[model samples]
Target: MAIHPTAVVDPAAAIDASASIGPYAVVSGPAVIGADCILMPAAIVMGHTTLEAGCRVHSHAVVGDMPQDLKYHGEVSYCRIGEGSVVREGATVHRGTLAGTSTIVGKRCLLMTNSHVGHNCELSDDVILVSGSLLGGHVYVGQRAIVSGNAAVHQHVRIGELSLVGIQARITQDVPPFCITDQEGNVVAENRIGMKRAGFSLAERSELRAAFGAIYRDGIGRNAAVQYLRGAMTTDAGRRLLAFYAHDSARGSGMRLYNEANAA
Candidate 1:
């Protein structure tokens, strides 16, 4: 381990040999940092948090802090960050609420600068919270979803897989898969570009288009539209879209129809 002289790390903390602690970083007791991770200047990793291999905690970021929830009562909780993730400058990722609950950040995810992930929030693999995005307590972000800069999600809301939440949007409900919503909470269109960049095949893209049409323009309720999508498209991607549409929360915002697809 290459720990800077100005850094202060607890003797009891488990830091891997391949990790690097930069100047003025402070790692308190009960923290475990894995291989190849980098803790930048003035960053603090405390409590019972575990940073998996290949992760990077940028300058001044704070991880594994106590929950802000009143019900926490000072109980012990864990924060687990998966491999190869990046927690950017000034970001704060708090631990769980109550005992046995975990605040998890999955592999390959990015929590941008100044973003705040509240207690009990879970971000699945490949999730991206843009600069200043704030996820309220107990919020869950599905895999590959992107919450744009300055967006705020309400507590307990679930953003489905591969969805795109536009800049500065306020989300109070679940977002269905492949949907894109704007700042005013309108479903402006589909996340075609995102899916394409994620290596979705042509047929899968077509299926998503068909599914979007069925869900928004078919003159049927969300459930009935999902049923139609299930019957019309048989790909695994199609199934995922239908499942998200079918499981949408009552107060959730619908996806939009933006003008054209942007190449990512």
Candidate 2:
């Protein structure tokens, strides 16, 4: 209830008693702001947006705006930010295009300054979108993945768990788990450092490295590699890597060899 007098919250909006709306913030009638959520100066939460408890919308961030898709014609859609997520200054997360659908940002995520998350994107827990990064519509960023500053991800791409995208890289294909793409957007190394930081066991890390080698260095076809890894590698980390390839991504199989040059 610390809403500033300068804030413009619609009478029909559902704002929790403990929520705080700062100066010049706008909350639309259909929007829902949960307990302990904070809307900083000039932030805009409109349309069918819902911010879960403890979420923070920093200054000038805009959520639940209409999607920019040419095919959109104002059918009902939504943008949902999960608990404890923080949308930093000047960032925008667009709503979905199709009726009843929603663009979702998962729990505890961080969207840095000026980042743009296009319509229908799903960002999983602990995902970090660095400053000025742009995610095209329908992109799926997996848990704990980090898209570095100024990088751009193509629509429909899937970035797997614990992956690291280098700064300003242009990502066009699916990036598998525990991998790192170079500035030129080529898969060049295992994200051993990230996995360690995430507390993967030594045995799990060893298995993941073997699985990566089997997929990329073995030179076998994608299907064969997947089958081989599924049976050979039994660690949790190994299973995670296999699961990423089991389903077909927009970029097709062998995501471990994503850029085709595979220098890892």
Candidate 3:
């Protein structure tokens, strides 16, 4: 409703009456701009994208552009920015590569300046991508996970809930929940601070720490580790961690646990 005179919003684009489009911003291709969404100066929202209520597309940021994948042949895919999410300056979020699929940024997620979410990447609620971080196509980032500045996640990798990926890290494997990774993508330790901030009790944190030790420090194989965790886990956090392992990873060999012997 507050579209700037210089903004170029397509007639077919469905913009809510409460939305504000800033100067020189472009909303095109029947994109749905939800209630109270704000397109900052020079932002671009294109393709089959949907900006849910209260979303903010910052200056020079682009959402819902065509995918970067070579497999894409202009199929009708989608990009969805969830309610209350913020895409910061110069960030780019591309649409899905496959037909009828979607790239989803969940509620309250923050994509910092110049960060890139590749085609088909799915980011869960409260996720944070620091400045210049890059997520490859089809990567799935769990809720409350933080990818530090300049980290690059390989395609199809899964970053679990409450995990912290270190700055400039190159993540090629699945990172288990409640963990923290080093620059080389090694799972170094549990995300104690993140868990503490998330309101996990002392007992829950202890249980998770024990689980990590069993899997990473004790040299237990995947089967034995799962069994040990299954019988020992008592808290909701512990169960969630077990469930993360239970799911099949896109990386065929499963996640690699931290090994002190391999550390530099």
Candidate 4:
């Protein structure tokens, strides 16, 4: 480990040989830093946390702080950062509460500058929290999703896979996969760009487009619409989208358009 002379690292902390600690960084008790991770100046890694290999903690970021929950009695919860992730400057990731038990940032995720991920937040692989986003306690974000800058996700909300949350939105409910939650927290459109980036083929994309059309444009009800799409549009993207509609409907309500045209 390349720890700067000015940094304070606890003797009990486990630092991998390949990790680099910058000037004035503080690594407190029971923390584990993995190989090739970088802790920039004045960053703090504390509590029972683990930073996986290739993670980057920028200046003044704080990880593994106790949860903000009133019921938290200092249980030994954790903040787990996965490999190749970036916790940007002044970001704060708090540990989970006894009820939820852990805050997990999956591989290749980005918690942007000044963002706050509260207790029990589960961010899946490739999830991106843009600068200043605040995820309230118990929020779950699925893989490849993007929570845009300054958005506030209410407690227990889930943002589904490949979804996009617009800046400053107040997200109080689940967002379905492959959908775009606009600044008003309404499902404005399908996340077509993100799907393309995730290697969805043209045919697959076409199938999803059809399914979305069926659900939002057709006069059919939600369950009947999903059933129709299942029979008519059979592709990987279509199946995924259908699954999102079904699961999200059961999980909790998403922001549904009042009119069919508004959904499209």
- TM-score each candidate: 0.92, 0.94, 0.95, 0.90
lDDT of 2 by residue, 2-66 (tens): 98999999988899999999999999859999999999999999999999999999999999999
Clashing pairs in 4: none
lDDT of 4 by residue, 64-128 (tens): 98888999997888889999999999999999899447899999999999999999989999999
lDDT of 1: 0.86
lDDT of 3 by residue, 81-127 (tens): 99999999999999999999999999999999999999999999999
Specify the poorest-scoring 10-residue window by lDDT in model 2.
Answer: 255-264
* Cα lDDT tens digits for candidate 1, 49-167: 99999999999999999998888788889999999999999999999988988999999999999999999899999999999999999888999999999999999888888999889
Q: In candidate 4, residue 252 scores what lDDT? A: 64
- Give the runs in model 4 whose Cα sits over 4 Å from its true position: 218-233, 248-251, 258-264
RMSD per candidate (Å) reads 2.4, 2.4, 2.4, 2.6
**What is candidate 3's CA lDDT for residue 122?**
96
lDDT, candidate 3, at 106: 99
Better of 1 and 3 by TM-score: 3
Off by over 4 Å in 3: 252-264
Give the higher-TM-score candidate: 2 or 3: 3
Model 3 score (lDDT): 0.91
Q: How much lDDT does each candidate structure score?
A: 0.86, 0.88, 0.91, 0.85
